[model samples]
Target: MQFLQFFLCITVLLLYCNVSRSAFLCELNQANPFKVALTSTVDIAGKGNFTTIQSAVDSIPSGNTKWIRIQIFAGVYREKVTITYDKTCIFLDGAGSRETFIEWDGHERTNTSATFTSYAENLVVKGIGFKNTYNLGPKQNDLVPALAAEILGDKAAFYNCSFFGVQDTLWDVGGRHYFYQCYIQGGADFIFGKGQSFYEQSVLYYSLETYGQGTYIGYITAQGRDSADDPSGFVFKDCVILGKGKAYLGRAWKAFSRVIIANSKLSDIVVPVGWDAWQFVGHEDQLTYAEEDNSGPGADTSKRVPWQKKLSEGVKGNGHVKFKCPTFLKFKVKAMAVTLSDDEVSDNESDKTGLGFVKSIFVPETHSPNFVPSSKPPVSEIVKQAEVTPPRKIRVDL
Candidate 1:
């Protein structure tokens, strides 16, 4: 049966190899960067390796390092799924968000209530929809924590997927992650946590469905970093936030919490006071909730919180400082006189994450010489320079 399926796969690929694409074969010990050499299929029908997603996941050995592809066919699977910690290097492929999904009705226990939870490293999930239907059912108005997905692993990414719930929709617990062109929806604190993540071109739908617990207003994020050295932040670059009721962009969930909404579109659903200090009233100067180059009715910051002042604080660098826009958790050099280097932030041990690479980075040209792209100082070098010229450290709150 395995040989017959392999023959059929080869026949199908040979018939559909494209001009700008190349066909990949499943081979062991091969050197292809896209190393999807083994496949485990999951389908509601009895036409694949496993009939259920959990059984397919159970087949993978612990500490597995190869790129194992689990292709899920078109269906709405009504089961709670979890990729365990030992099952690393998985590529979950689905038909489409509208055509394929996994959901459950787990209502209590925020730590274990997710319909889909991934705790593995080097994982890539695409085209799947995770929904916790507890609040969407008969208890639609319950202000409870129903998480669609909780990501707590390193070097994981999601693309073209959807996460749905009422509150705490995505628990980006910790790690470095990237979400590209995905859709996330919830009522309060929908997208929260301390993960160092880059959300690029994603869509946020804030449904003010069950918001009446704390302050009567909804909060889009509850991100909280531990300290100045904590490498955890949520950077939403070039995204869209749309909804009905008035909501603050985020509130300080911790003392040194950090969130940046940059180059995004905000509808009138956003409140005039953009952010809330929550319990961090005395430590407002410690947290960082910044907005850059946003537009639309809600983007009007005339009535925003005084702490979040306009960038009219003025520029202090060499005219303009530029960093590469987000692209799949990657960074590039801009070739400017004093631009950051194309440093690889993947699998690094430093507490400073990719966004941290830009924190307090710009040193006035008067303090230093003209730095070409290759000669740009590393993030650590700036700290050493601070020891020399303490006044030259221009702190950026990203």
Candidate 2:
């Protein structure tokens, strides 16, 4: 017993020492770094490395650039940009969410000509606004997959970023991605793709379009791909789902399209059924849309779709099932904390700092402020749609 106690004490001491050293090193790095404004005015007012985003991207090492930081000033960059696969560990630090805007407009349903071969991967577009400006002019919906940025590679992470679009806003067309503190907006099937994505502490906005007279159109956020042991699924934890026009949290576009919304807030705007199989493909058997201790007006089980499972009491809800099984199984709210930080840290801080760590530490009574029940109208109510009048051809600000 004494030996065990001694060993444990030594381990703790070593860990503490390692963590302290790491914190010191991180502080040292943060002490001085290049600010885009002070460093250069490639586009703004300073003398930075390059004027355009593409130029900066071209100048970087294509094969493997470690910790390549690009600070984007507060400006609306109106262009379609694609970060190639060779660009790795690219960090885009924005001035602020509203200040920085990367705007474009593309939709899969509307645009049939825009072509892209998906080979880009291993990138991080953080701390900026990705806006879709395609509908602002005479041109409308001509951009297919009009992604402000399309992540088609593996191991991508988008942090503190904003994705704005109508349809197919974010193509999770990659592998093992993590989105933290990001704001994603779309209209119809906006955030749909086959990539395995985990969105934590993010804000999701769905737009409501008119459907005939008195009817309104809604949006679907995700669509998983064809994979038996996908190992990748949509895990939305501590997120806010809000919008107008009877939006359902998801629609299974493909069989085995799985989503797990746990300890998150769902706005009343979400349809009572929570999810729908796109046009009833008959693969509802493989679809897994589930929730645990979720709140809101949209969370009422009485009106859920017949195919959707409410996870009633029994072996399923008994906290014995493993989340890794890929089946429509339930697990105890396995509380894990993934600490999100700006940069990498040493082993000590990696052990101590909760930055970018995924720990399922969910307490039903207490969750993040943005976390809410799907049945209840979210605190941040959806932008109310005003009654539309016949277009009278306005010249300015139509």
Best by lDDT: 1
Off by over 4 Å in 2: 1-46, 106-121, 136-145, 209-214, 309-398
Cα lDDT computed for each candidate against the true fold = 0.64, 0.49
Assess the local accuracy of residue 118 in candidate 2 as a C-alpha lDDT between 0 and 100: 25
Pick out the ten consecutive residues of candidate 1 with the lowest summed lDDT. 1-10
Q: What is the lDDT of residue 53 in candidate 1?
A: 87
lDDT of 2 by residue, 212-330 (tens): 21255565566765544343457776666765566778887677576667656676778777787886467675666666556677666577666654333331245322222111001
Q: Candidate 1's residue-wise lDDT over 320-371, tens digit each?
A: 2132332321222111111111221111223232223222111122211111
> Could you list the CA RMSD of all candidates, in the order they appear?
16.6, 12.7
The whole-model C-alpha lDDT of candidate 2 against the native structure comes to 0.49
Model 1: per-residue Cα lDDT at residue 331? 23
Error of 1 at 72 (Å): 0.6
Q: State TM-scores per candidate.
A: 0.73, 0.65
